[model samples]
Target: MAISITQFASDSNLLNTPLWDKQSEILEEFWAGNYAIAVWALGRRSGKTLMSAIVATYCATMLADEYKRHLRPGEKFYIISVANTIDQAKIALQGVKDLINGSPILKPLIVRETTDTLELRNGAVFRALTASSRSGRGMACPLLIFDELAHAVDTEAGNAAGSSLYQALSPSVAQFGKIGKILLLSSPWIQSGIFWDLYKQAASGNFAHMQVVQAPTWEVNTTISAEFLEQEKARDPELFKVEYGAQFTGNIAAFIDNQLVDAAINSDRGLLPPLNKFNGTYYLALDPAKGGRDAYTACIVHYDGELVVVDQFHQFAPTWGDGKKTQVAVSLVEDWILEQHKAYGFASVVLDQYNSSSTIQRLSGRVKIRELTWTASSKTEAYSKLRELFNGGSIELYPHPKANGQIKNLTVTYRPNGTWGVSGGTGAAVDDYPSALAGAVLMATNRINKQQIIPAKSYRTW
Candidate 1:
């Protein structure tokens, strides 16, 4: 008799309790099909990691002998599990370890274990890796799993990296023919990427062998109450549509182009020397931290006839303590600004009004302060100007890791108020870096326009 996934779970010590109804359905459907790829668009807390662990574990142990039959003498095969980051990949691998640890029947099969790999005595190996096309290359993988695949995009280009990664690994996966299996699962994101493409294809029956499942949190977990979902929807309806409703958000999109940002970065350059090293007037911009949750960030830039060059970027720690028990002193942050002003002699300083009144007062007589009270309209204008500079090749960025990261992760969302909001996306905790950079660019652009230092055609859209 052929082994069923449901029967394997029930008979083995894999789970302390019986599988959830929806989980069993998902497993049964995939197991019974001749699918080379199974794409799951599930809601948050819907047990994606757990499901991946179960499938990978089963193939690595019970089906190891059968899977290795086609391999040449002494050829190695891998059951690879990947996630957006190393930390996330570790969580998936830990899920497999937890199952093995709890099961007396499966525990003895482990011949060796490492940080990112588990090797069974039957010569089958399970490895966890960070999501990258390079990482997937040159491996003979029979089983491959992608957790939170929707977030695996090309950070600089603001496009999906999933297609490139899939292409790189698909040849190896195809080598196994009927034995090869690829599992991709994530909470639904924007309507782009390989996940969305595969989902639509499966729905249209374009591929007769592919399996696709769309499961909401309540359906899969059953423990999430309606009251909790109600509160979440009330908190953020648009976000709720994507997170709980398991729907794609058409309003969400990447703010900047990858090649544009890449070309703007001066890779060989470090932070430019202060005002004395250059002849152009300098502009400084600050984005103050709030509630001890964000970094206090600042940027310094100047227009040098042809381009707006970012000379300096600074991000002060928001708090210091073993358990975030102490907030950073505002006075210390002010002192650092004062110190920078002395070196740059900024022609003018621009800052958002949020949590910045005290800083303005301290530097009142010491510097020329231009207070910007951000409104929906004003932010759109400022951020739009920054994007224009990037597209026109009118900006040059010094090497700043935080600034680069925030720029790459920025998202543009259409608000209900009939305006566009530029903010951070998943895994981007704060956008202070880009905020300050945009402010600095806006100030420099305005000053250059007022002075008529460059031809109108030179910076018309820049």
Candidate 2:
């Protein structure tokens, strides 16, 4: 007995021949299970596109055949592949074409076109589409593959055409006996977006998900040496993580040392000591800007043995009218602090007093609000102090997921004048959050009584 093309391809010999890594195993399992959705997250140059194309090609040819055999002729079986742009779509399809060309048996069944589609002899089609919301309209597809879905724009006019396209294709897939399969592949970009939501859902076991593969630069190929990665880390650690770590860290280029920031994050345990026991008091730091693209960022910190950032609030305002919205924001901050104080009693609130005098004055009467002066020289000093605290493990962050998003936006840089400036990137402005945190540490650890409280307990004792 001779095996068919589909059978041969499905055999372990053929499937495992092309360097079957962990991602391939997951994809094969997902396909075999007829999963409704599968997300593949790989770092740069992990051959994600190639793997995606292979899956799409298999669905277009082998899976479509299986689907048609279980139904009548003239039934629709479509493989719709999309990417952030037309060029990216082309690149994805190119990998499909390469896969087909490399396989002697599969090459004969594929009809390649310059536009980047593979029309199988079995009447199944593999068409490359752009991520434009318009692209998915009025088309029925059984299989949907979205490459780099994170970068797709979600228009404000309530017109998510790209997303809508996928929704539209659902019925067509459901018409078949099997559940529709949607494969979303991308590197991390923005922290909060449609893609992030989908990824989270998949990760949380909300869906029948396969695996999330993180192919860092080191894992991609030998060309990306550790020395090169170290160089990139030296240049800007946040950028290196974003570029190579497959971390969707929003622009944090302006902070002093991103490596230090990354190191500060506690991956093992998110717990911190009780706020009241560590510091006798707590303070809220505010960096105010007139309502514009940048809004005021407020950070609330508690001083324990070190400075601990308890919470952060940020809002954007594009005009003076928006700035007027600060009252509502201020009220929210007050409520937050009151809640925190109730949880762990705090001493007072410290704020940058220049622009927010009125706001400060308004809050001071209710809760203790002290104004902290920001000198040009102190900016560097404060940033250095923060680094020291972070490295020394004196600071603890709230384990809220939002804190990760905030941290991703922080960057560090040294000024030409031998000073350092920590800035926020990716639609974030003002160093208020870090500043407040640093202020809390300063106030807590600063020797006011000329005495230090040493912990009687040690790690060995614990």
Candidate 2, which segments miss by more than 4 Å at Cα?
1-17, 69-72, 154-165, 209-224, 248-254, 258-462
Model 1 residue pairs with clashes: 156-258, 157-258
**Which candidate has the top score in TM-score?**
1
Model 2 over residues 356-452: C-alpha lDDT tens digits? 5665656655565556566665555556556555555556665445444445556664321113456655453444455556555444444333432
| TM-score of each model, paired residue for residue | 0.59, 0.51
Model 1, 4-32: lDDT tens per residue?
77776676565453577899999889978
Q: Model 2, 47: alpha-carbon shift in Å? A: 1.1
Clashes of each: 2, 14
Candidate 1 regions exceeding 4 Å error are 252-462
TM-score of 1: 0.59
Candidate lDDT values, in order: 0.77, 0.57
Q: What is the lDDT of residue 358 in candidate 2?
A: 64
